[model samples]
Target: RGFVVFHAKFAENYRLYSRSHFVKGIELMILLIVYEIFGQPYRSPVAYILITVSMWFMVGTWLFAPFLFNPSGFEWQKIVDDWTDWNKWISNRGGIGVPPEKSWESWWEEEQEHLRYSG
Candidate 1:
């Protein structure tokens, strides 16, 4: 159960890490996976297990250290509200159709109007 909570928190922190460092995070995970898979065959089981566990612990540390240290003040509700307001402003001012409800014709017309006015 404790591992479960740790895993959940790790997952969230991993998500944050991925969002913040998209390409690098994906590359790191891929390389780690490749190393584990390919390197396992050459090494003794004990060595392999120890190394992989250590690697994952390091990955976990990388994920959670920033999470614990840097509470980036990410307010989800405020972000959503700001996005909604921006969407409304853009739609009202003719950027495109509103976010949730959209149509091809309306989108095309709005884009056309935008192009006409901007140029």
Candidate 2:
């Protein structure tokens, strides 16, 4: 049935959306879920309804609820290709490398240089 195909596609999209780090992905997944579940007739008489429903259940429990309730901001790609263990890897890989204590050193130098030109 046409509805069944749509449901299958929705499930696939939902899976990707839940796992994706980008905001658009999550939004797409939520939209698909609403289309299939919330926007529909009370129940489908089709026999395959159970199958797609199970797919939705699996995707929801494994992905959607977890992402919605306790989302992690960390990108998955960074950890996937990592060669070392968590302890060895630098958690601040994307941030400035300068240490907090020495940050004022660079800030002071830049400020002094700016004052020299203005004065």
Candidate 3:
């Protein structure tokens, strides 16, 4: 039973991750096409703007892709707000974001809690 549950969860996560990467790859391709078209010397202002917006969209999608298919409802506004705050603070401080150790500890705790309740 435990193995079946783990396999199912793993499959779900793998599917989500694959889907996210596939979308990101498509975004990247679009960005590259836009760049190739408008990223040359003596480009018009409008072309530059288009390229910039395309790049931003690609990056935003890459950053937030994982949360798009989250089982817990998509909190787009909250995620954007949090990211904005973190970006502003990081720009001011010129420091790194969440430490890996701390992040790993929290993730471990969450996994253990989930298992405890799930089983």
Candidate 4:
């Protein structure tokens, strides 16, 4: 009776484990083996579809959906405010704007001098 119960318990655990992981693991292993066997010249349509689907899922769910999923995790409102301040500061500079190639330190000095002289 004790031996029978022990065997039954082991079998039950084995069955549960097999059900949870064995089928998926075996399928993945078989797929890898098949992929290795199939030379590059003969491509699998299913594999291409799977790869395309995965790429679409990743880009659509994460990259493009910024409001839903921010890749940088920056607040949208803060970003908008920063853009607004940058535009305001840039536009306020007189028609003769700072040259693009100048370093920030040099540009700042020139901007300060201009403001002081113009004021």
Candidate 5:
């Protein structure tokens, strides 16, 4: 279970970081091209400022994407609250506390049943 949780978190972080970095890399390439073409001689401060501002905006948007684009329309705070509640419930009565007599299949079925009625 610990291994699975670690891998799941790692995969999710990898996916998010890779996607954002790929986009930033493309943006950097475009900026480099622009700098080479027009700003090479002048080394315009305006161009530098634009690039900096745009990069910051991109970072901000990526950081806030989960909150901005949540399909469920829940606020970030509400989502955090719900996640903590679920974690507490699971720790107290679900996977972490499964009885020795219960097989994995039965434990899973019990979880599903709990979800069906609770949710």
Candidate 6:
């Protein structure tokens, strides 16, 4: 029998060459700024929810969607348009607050709830 089974270096090189990188760190930075302004949950619940939803969609569209699914003959109109539309930064300036109970149980429960509804 002929041997032709081992090609680890070539395979790794090819895989690394084909990694998806549609969205870069700069785009995420812009989105982070947007989130800081309109998405701060402590400032306004509605605005926070809106920003969260928008950022979620942006992440899905730019980060995971392009690589995972390739729609037939599909193209994008603009790069990271989902997060770039916000023109104002209110800068309400709020810091992260500790959750009630100061323990991991409540956090786990919240994560479980999110997973249950998210899926």
The candidate that achieves the highest TM-score relative to the unseen native structure? 1
Q: 41-69 in candidate 3: lDDT tens per residue?
A: 68887777675776767666665555554
lDDT of 4 by residue, 61-106 (tens): 4322333332233556655654554454445443355542222333
Q: Which residue pairs come into collision in candidate 6?
A: none
Q: Name the runs in model 4 displaced over 4 angstroms.
A: 1-10, 39-119
For candidate 3, the 10 contiguous residues with the lowest summed lDDT are: 5-14
Cα deviation of 110, candidate 4, in Å: 83
Cα-based lDDT at residue 85, candidate 3: 49
Candidate 2 lDDT (Cα, whole model)? 0.42
Q: Which has the better TM-score: candidate 3, or candidate 4? A: 3
Estimate the overall C-alpha local distance difference test score of candidate 6. Answer: 0.41
Give the range of the ten consecutive residues with the poorest summed lDDT in model 4.
Answer: 5-14
lDDT score, candidate 1: 0.51
lDDT of model 6 at position 28: 68
- Residues 3-72, candidate 6, lDDT per residue (tens digit)? 5543222212222322343335347657777767766356775666665676656655555544344332
Q: Could you give me the TM-score of model 1 versus the true structure?
A: 0.34
Clashing pairs in 3: none
lDDT of 5 by residue, 1-119 (tens): 35331112222332345446546665766765576577657667676767577665665665556445544436566566645544443454435556412333334465357667774
All candidates: CA RMSD (Å) = 13.1, 17.2, 13.0, 24.8, 15.5, 19.7
The better candidate by TM-score, 1 or 5, is: 1
Q: Identify the runs in model 5 with alpha carbons over 4 angstroms from their true place.
A: 1-48, 72-77, 83-119
lDDT (0 to 1) per candidate: 0.51, 0.42, 0.51, 0.44, 0.51, 0.41
Instruction: Give the poorly placed runs of model 3, Cα more than 4 Å off.
Output: 1-15, 19-23, 26-38, 44-46, 51-55, 69-119
Which residue pairs in candidate 1 have backbone atoms (N, alpha carbon, C) closer than 3 angstroms, thus clashing?
none
Whose lDDT is higher: candidate 2's or candidate 6's?
2
Sequence-dependent TM-score of model 3: 0.29
* Candidates 2 and 4 compared by lDDT, better number: 4
Task: Put down candidate 1 lDDT per residue, 1-119, tens digits, no spaces.
Answer: 35332222322333345445544545666777888787748788788667678666666665546545544324565446545654554455333434322323444464356667774
